[model samples]
Target: MRITRRKRLLIGLVAGFFLVFVTGLRAFDPGFVTSIRLLGFDGYQRLWPRTEADYPVRIVDIDEKSLAKFGQWPWRRDRLGELTTALAGMGAASIAYDVIFAEPDRLSPHRYLPELTREGATGTELPDALAKSLPDTDEVFARAIAGAPVVLGYAVLSGDGGSTPALKAGTAFAGSDPTDALPAFASTLTSLPVLEAAAAGNGAVSLSARDTEGIVRRVPMLFTDGTRVYPSLAMEALRVAQGASGFIVRTSDASGEIGVGPPKVTDIKVGDFPFPTTERGEFWVYFNADRADRYVSAADVLDPQKRAAIAPLIEGRIILVGTSSVGLYDIRATPLGELVPGVSIHAQALEQILSGDFLSRPDWADGAEIIATFLLGLAVIGLVLAFGAIWAAAIGGILAAILYGGAIHFFRNQGLLLDPIYPTAVNLFVVYAAATALLYFLTEREKRFVRAAFGQYLAPEMVKRLEASPDGLKLGGEMRDMTILFMDVRGFTPISEQLTPTDLVAFLNALLSPLSEEIQQREGTIDKYIGDSIMAFWNAPMDVADHARLACRTALDMVRTVDRLNEADAFRFRARGLATQTVRIGVGLNTGEACVGNMGSDRRFNYSVIGDAVNVAARIESSCKAVGADCVVSEDTARAAADFAFLEAGAIPLKGKTTPIKLFALVGDADHAATEAFKTLADAHARLVDAIDANDVARALAGLASCRALAPAALHDFYDRFAERIDAMAVAAPA
Candidate 1:
């Protein structure tokens, strides 16, 4: 199907927003960010359970308890010899120490490198005098080391030049090229300098994640030799644990990329665009720390007695020994926290890569980000321009915040880092700023429209809504239950005719200002105005529940307002000059269905009320002046206005009607008690209807007089009008 202009605009806006959101992903690192937070301190503990394995490579930790029982760190080498011998005796597969032995023990004959041929040693000098004078501890330690699978610790560093030790034939990593089929980029990998001689291959633990500002965010996976990549600490641990010969690296020919892969699914989440990755495989982390099966600390197994504690914990485990103590200063800052262990961070990355649960940002992510920003900008501008500045601002802020938070969550939880920061921030700034500028122009234009449409007649608020939802400005009507009010300033035409044009305009401005403010304040919509009159209604545009009460209350408030105006000292109008003399206003209220909204020709449209309810309200207002009552309301309005006290005026013939309409006067605040008393008396008068029906006119007439006495002056004045009409009707009745 063909799409409309608005629909096409929506589609384009959405497409643009997605593009912007995805492009933002390139600004962040996935594995580095996710690994740190996911494997927090608590997560780190899971990799290291405090228990021994029965069969396999295991880690034994030198806990604080073991340290207290044994000697301090760097114990006599003979003790280490004994521990190694015991592990060899237990048939351990292999023993790897995370500790470094860069320096010789002081107890050795040379105090650094003792000669193997030395037969015996007592103090610093091994006896050259005797053939087998009992070798020093160094010889004993060397003997133990030769008897077991002892893998020593070594670290790699980057430098301009370094001496290359002769390669041990069996010690190098044996593997296929892991990156053979990968796409190439600028060399971001750093080199490692390796020189060591122990039992097995060495590995690196270098984390290289960056922060929001693109600083290093996490540990690197593997240390390189400025040419080739080597296994990391965690990878080495996995190798030791699995007893694997080496990592398997598979490669396929470029044109020989024969197999069709599964279709990829992209998640365009709610927030900012994510960091782009080359493919699905780049984001992940390995988990390793504190596992009884994986790590061993040197401080534990040195003591022969404490060695039992470790053997039970590390006999068949793959243990990683990294710093948890704050003072070790091995912690690195991450999005997760500043105290995350540098070593464990690498472990998490390894785990993710191995599990193949990487956060994928396709090369298309950049386009996604650009699109997301554009779309969000359009939405923000549209809302702001279509509504007002306040609503537009609210929507823009909410959308921006949601998108930003969503991108971060997707990264951390799903291994997908959609970079939302830049796009969301840019969207908010650009959209709001642009929308504000546009709105300012629209507002200025609207003022002109207001002047053209209603400056000659209608209220300012009406003009604002007309511009706000211009669709509602059509000449149509909706039937709505509304409270209609009619207000007239008594005898204003003669006064206006006598005054100059300037004085008339000034007077009208002054009088209408407070009166219009009063109506609007009560949420009453002004329908229209006759000469010196205000016709308004409630429950339109937005419906109010107690609109009838609101209408009546506004009428009462207007009555009080006139008195205050008459008392004011700023007397300029003809009526304002009169001393303490109140100007009279007649108000009528009715509640019923009326056609409301713009109700006129296209050239001269107006938001107004039409139909019988409006006519009755006007009739009631006119009846107020004719019957000498300040305010009159239909019984329907009176019933709905529970807040105001109402007193009944007997039914009277209204002009252009044979049916006598039931009416009530609106009593002001002081008359509440009197009005309530009148209700009671009126109830009694109604009961007298039964008396009159029984031909007991005496009691009926008596109750009527009682009702008159109890009512307030306004109600009584209405009752006197009723009495004159009743008397005339009775006299006019034929015998």
Candidate 2:
């Protein structure tokens, strides 16, 4: 097939569309694409997790053992005050709580005394002045918080709420407004006013999943509640430890970042350390395997005997007060597949910033990926237009391999994130789509030749197969095992005499249409129509499974079709003002090896079979009238199609064969063959053949009688013919 300029241009248009669609998807960056891209970055972390190193971060866990040592949660505020005082005494650098003190302590003396004074019948009231003198537990906890560098946590909400988080640090930005890029919340949930005011820093404890399935992959460095900005728990802890007064943030409009198209937060500085952040002022934390050394049981911290051992771990470390108890519901998932306390995420974020080992996805990554995809995908489409899809796809595979290798190298060595999936997919899809369009055009151009050759002879589906792959079929022949069929109308000469020329054509078309349908429906190829007969065969052009059985089934179906046509008044005998006549058909089947293919010359040919088996089938169809059977098959077909109800017709002299060939009468299908009546008829017919071979006149007559008694009503004529043959044999056997 030669390429045309118009077709080549069409292919180009198709390939270009594919490239655009894929590149546009990357630009749109839907949730699914984000998920796959994030998954690639996650694979890097899983391959080489962050190394476990000593950092100034620790979790003072209120685990199940701590609960057992003290009591269940919501313990009196006085105990929390004691824990705070103890940490301060140990010289802890910073204490960040992953818990909310939203409500006042219920165990305070003033709290219960006022309730008792209202319920006088309970008789547990104290004097108003004495109750006022008693200390408030929340106040005690607040005083302890004031003594140490404590950062209290608050929750972020997306729904309607009235409360707002306390702002502990003032944010100063250089270029664009930092609040424009940071995540904004509708409202916030803050802790108790006294505790929040007394703490050195107040920060958000909440962590957003982004697209990591509830896994903490990104931590917000700053948040906004529409008007005010707030720092995260980790950021506040870092600031308090360093004794920094405020934060410095920079954006795209800054001096060094001015050429960018849009404003995006570029850098943040807490005291002496300068750090980079995502456009939304978020920090990407590289995670390591959870370290057991990073935790100290709160119960152990309060115990006098254990305090000495834990003091060294707590002295310079930023202690996060949180619970690891399953009942606390403070657990969070990570890329490493471990569920750790929520406080650990905040602690890790600080560790990442302090250590200065980071992973960053630059703003230019998407543009780079799109440009690579368009250039590479265009190369493949050009190759498809010039050479074809095969060469183009081969080169595309090489390009994809190179792209993946570079992406993986960047991730491992440079700690940079790049997506290789979108570009590779674009190349593959454009090449495949262009190739399919080319095939369809080529097939359409050559289909006329195929349709003229086998369109009339073979079924529509078979013609389609040839059209798809013209190479598979050629002007040649191959010997294959096939089942041949020959069907003819009974008493055609007599019927022709009754109808006019036009009526004869009409009658034949009406009769042959249904009979031909029966053959084609069973996957048999109709070779041609000879007068009132149909010649067909199976297992040609394509391999038909169980071709022999299918032939037998077609034979039975044609017989039934003719009977139906006769019952439907299709003969048209009465319309001619003559006595009504019935229609009958005879079908012959034989299975054997034969040469089946295009048998004629190159320019003009027909897909037909030619061999001794085909002749045998024609001869067997002629013998149907002599045997008084509607359907007859040779011994070869009977052996292959034993599941059908076939009774032996004994050895008879077929015209061309040297010896007599055995024949069978096909009566019914597999279900009828399984019946006891068919079994009885088969047994009696076998005995009759044996007696005829033995020349036992008495036994032969008796067997013939038994066969007639067991056979169907329509088969009485067949048994009568068998009886006549037996009588002729007895006479020739003269004693």
Global local distance difference test of model 1: 0.55
The global C-alpha lDDT for each of the candidates, from Candidate 1 onward, is 0.55, 0.84
lDDT of 2 by residue, 1-735 (tens): 334566677778877887777778878989887887777777778887776789988889999999999999977887898899988888898899989999998878678668777789557667778878988999999999999999999888888764887788988887867676778888778889999899999998877647466777888888887676788888888888888988888887888775366677877888877777888888877899878888899999889888888899999778899988989898988877789888888878878788887778877898998898778888877777776667767887888889989988887787778888778865686545655566567668657767887676666777777676565553478888999999998888888887889989999999998888788778788999999999999888667789999999999989888888877777666556554378888899999999988877767778889999999999999899887899999999999998999988878788888998899999999999999988988898899989988888889999999988888888987888888988898788868
Provide TM-scores for the models. Answer: 0.46, 0.60
The sequence of per-residue lDDT tens digits that candidate 1 reaches over residues 196-274 is 3434435444444332333233333333343444444545555544555555321221222332343211111101112
Q: Cα deviation of 425 in candidate 1 (Å)?
A: 8.0
lDDT of model 2 at residue 187?
Answer: 76
